[model samples]
Target: MVTTTGVLFIVAAVVLFFFWIYGIVSFYFDLRYRFLPAVREHLRDDEQQARPDPEEYL
Candidate 1:
């Protein structure tokens, strides 16, 4: 006694939920593996450049 619209809605909900989970897992791994390293590298470069010379009148 189920309608076609109900079945379609259920299917769509399941598909969307799977996609949501996939996005979360992908984002976590990407941020951990790629983003953190890149950010660290960028920060290191910043630290290496434009540094003030040490005061000689200490």
Candidate 2:
């Protein structure tokens, strides 16, 4: 019984590890392919619109 339990625990651990690795990899690829460009474009637009003009401030 103890051996069976140990084996089951190990199997569960490995399965969870695989899923964790898969999630991390998928997240990274999704961010790189789908999200980064949009984020960068948003930031660029915000920066362009938010620039401070000294004359305006004066």
Candidate 3:
């Protein structure tokens, strides 16, 4: 019974680790392919525009 439990725990740990890795990798590729260019463009626009005063937003 103890051996079985240990094996189950190990399997679960490995599966969870793989899932975490997969999520990080997926997010990186998705951002690189889908969102990075838009983000860069927005940043460039912000830099080109005059800096806004923080009080203006309030």
TM-score for each candidate, following the candidate numbering: 0.65, 0.65, 0.63
Every candidate's lDDT: 0.94, 0.95, 0.93
Going through the candidates in the order shown, the clash numbers are 0, 0, 0
TM-score of 2: 0.65
Q: Report the lDDT tens digits of candidate 1 across residue range 8-49.
A: 999999999999999999999999999999999999989977
Candidate ranking under lDDT, highest first, comes to: 2, 1, 3
- Of the two candidates 1 and 3, the one with more favorable lDDT, higher being better, is 1
lDDT of 3 by residue, 13-53 (tens): 99999999999999999999889998999999988687787
User: TM-score of predicted model 3?
Assistant: 0.63
Cα displacement (Å) at residue 9, model 3:
0.3
Off by over 4 Å in 2: 43-58
Q: Taking the tens digit of each residue's C-alpha lDDT, what string does model 2 give over 1-58? A: 4698899999999999999999999999999989999999999999988998778977
